[model samples]
Target: MDELFQQADRLSSSHIRDRIVEQLYKQSNQLIKAGVTFSKAQHNERTEKLDAIFTSPIFGFPIMLVMLGTVFYLTIAGANIPSSMLADFFGWVEGYLTVSFNNIGAPDWLHGVLVLGLYRGTSWVISVMLPPMAIFFPVFALLENYGYLPRVAFNMDRLFKTVGAHGKQSLTMAMGFGCNAAAVMSSRIIESPRERMLAILTNNFVPCNGRWGTLIILSSLFMASGFTGGMKSIVTTSVIVGIVIVGIMTTFLVSWLLSKTALKGVPTHYTLELPPYRKPKFFDTVVRSSLNKSLSVLYRAIKVAAPAGILTWVLANIQIGDTSILLYIVNFLDPLGQLIGLDGYILMAFLIGLPANEIVLPILLMGYLSTGSLMDVDGIEDLKQIFLDHGWTWITALNMMLFSLLHYPCGTTLINIYKETKSMKWTFWSFMIPTAIAFLVTFAVAQAALLFGWG
Candidate 1:
């Protein structure tokens, strides 16, 4: 047997593998012929029709877009009430904490740091992160449970192959919509080490649940001024869908670049079986997805966000000369931020929001309110008024959306990448690559807007 394997190895690997597969099929067919009816159709007609539509070269992508848009629509529309309730509950709790701290005669700075800073930060994260994750993950898991996820991978396999990455990267990218850190962990499903690393590096391109909350908020605000009725909802959903498509395109572009550069490799072929769709087990899916994906991600975000809240409070409160340290940092970052079509406050928010993407807008609102604390602005109209007061043009909103979509992964995701890759070098590149692309894309957009005098 060893000598026979050595002889087979002398031929081209592809040819040898093909011959082995042919021989195996030949033997299997001989036994199957004893009782099988060769004329009978193998698959159910309905299953075949569904696969034809879902995996069609032309209709496949559009179907995917429609489904994706529907999921986002449901998440955005459904999460609003829950998010508001959570925010209110957290705010009420914060009030009690503040009163208790004062009654205890805690130092003013300590009160600010603990109640106003740390408590508020964690609260904002939960209030913002939980609703979306709770809504998004179950719906996504439903698709997975119904076995449509593998079909998605099957459809995108050709494109990923072109980029020298595994088609399984699509599976991991889908996981990113729930949480990038989870997506990094999911990359283990890819058998190829190089492709797995590629997936980890590019997973940040997709807007995770935290970033989705920001995008949905901004997209709704953008639509509010010009659209109404069902049209408004349609337009808002379309805009978000468009942003998601752009992220996917960016993922492809970056994958192609990496394939040709430091991570050069040939794409490995793998078979993907599209399982028959079935009724999703609702209760099991909901329980498992909520506990496994939503709560797990929320816990990580809270861990990082607690310290971030205290740090943000310190920066906002501690003054240097005439400006607070927060303002000074914003001032220093202003020119670059302007070049990318954002303001000092916006940039500052992103910096401090490093702990969790869910906190970016909250931190920005805090800065804009100038209250030395994060304030929950009620309604899209109130949020719009704040932006208008701060001189936010549509261009500013648009560029910020673009930047948010393209920016580096949140701190939790970064840590996950480090742990998964077990290489600081790969992890650093994972950070730098996305940061570079984000700045370049935003800079070009900013320059184009300036040249065209776009609002």
Candidate 2:
């Protein structure tokens, strides 16, 4: 048996292969220098210099972090006014819709289901979720078009591989910025089954578009409350970036632990190709991202939120004795939710939001107002008032943001996990693992806050 594969062992030595490739590249560079003309040092003179700074030992990760902070800042700060405007327009439209339904002699139940339930939920999703995604995807597309995403993979590769994940998992995590379900599918790029599974399970650690609105609003409303103007936005962005760093660090920890336990395996080598950076056509990139990514995601969110609205309306309106069914459920979950620094309504909203996270805020608002239908706040001030009315402190806001980062993936992502793995056991683990982690992390924070009188 040893003799049969003696030559194969030599072929499979990663060190030898790496050295050979390095020598080949070195020779290729020498030949290019000898043969190529000076006039053709080329337009990528800037590219070489940028790569040196961007990928340097001294500056590489710092640049990456700066870029990340910048993106979050833009997404958080830039989305504000447009989101408020969209909310106003949607509110106006909802009022007109209610009047139209009344003038047409529509039944109260019909109005509740369509106008109050479906329309409100869908509009809230559009107004809140759309602007961030609209701003985020275009800027991300700009970075992607300029060929910087691969550098992200490159910069994070050693860390991931050291933690027993594939380098390309970074790319899938980036894709998770768009959609976790899509990121699950994108994990196909990882050839090793164990590493691929690791990537799939941890993809939710990088908050998706569905979770962004909640984090941004909560951070701005609570974390930056004392500040005003540009200072407020800066503080909000910093908090958001801090939350993102937590998510990323959690990903690394989970990947490491799983690699040392159930998913234990040797890391597989992935050859990363760095492409020449090109100036992206900003307008075209924006148009394509807005139309292709943002609008498409918005449409899917509406489809899910619409049905959620109907269910929530039925639950909130239908009574079991003196209390609505939704309240009863919230009451049942209150003890558990309180243990984690969130209330019953927040828990119920999260459970309902399993289908689509965009609906969580609306359901929470409905639960707060007992409105028999989902609601969208008029502005940040209105939202702040609502949260205050519900006893939301900074601890609550912080815990909620952490849970949003760590909780179970949406239904679509779960189904994709099942389909991708073809193993119900693994899919169940994926759901349970993140859910358990979220509860445990929040419980610790809540307890620590209480012990120190910080709550």
lDDT of each: 0.85, 0.89
Clashing pairs in 2: none
Point out where model 1 deviates above 4 Å.
1-34, 37-43, 95-107
| lDDT by residue for model 2 (1-455), tens | 88757765667465566778899989988998888666636666777888888888789998888898888889888888888888788888888998999899999989998988888888888989988998899999999999899888888987997798888999999999889989999999998999999999899898899999898888988999999998998998889888888889999999999999999998888788888899899999999999999998888899899999888898998988998898899989999999999999999999999987787888788778776665656567887898899899999999999998899999989999999999999999999999999999999999999999995
Lowest summed lDDT window (length 10), candidate 2: 370-379
**Model 1, 1-455: lDDT tens per residue?**
99998988788664676588769868977788777665434444566789989999999988898899899888877777898899888878877888898898999999888877788778878887788889889999999998788889989987998888998999999889887888999999899998998899999999888898788878888644698766677777888998899999999999999999988998887777677778899999999999988898888778877887787888888988878888888889899999998899899999888878888887787677664576656556887999999888887888888889999888888999999989999989888988899899989988999999997
Stretches off by above 4 angstroms in model 2 are 1-24, 36-39, 374-376
TM-score of each: 0.88, 0.94
Q: Return the TM-score for candidate 1, rounded to 2 decimals.
A: 0.88
Worst ten-residue run, lDDT, model 1? 38-47
Clashes of each: 0, 0
TM-score of model 2 (CA atoms): 0.94
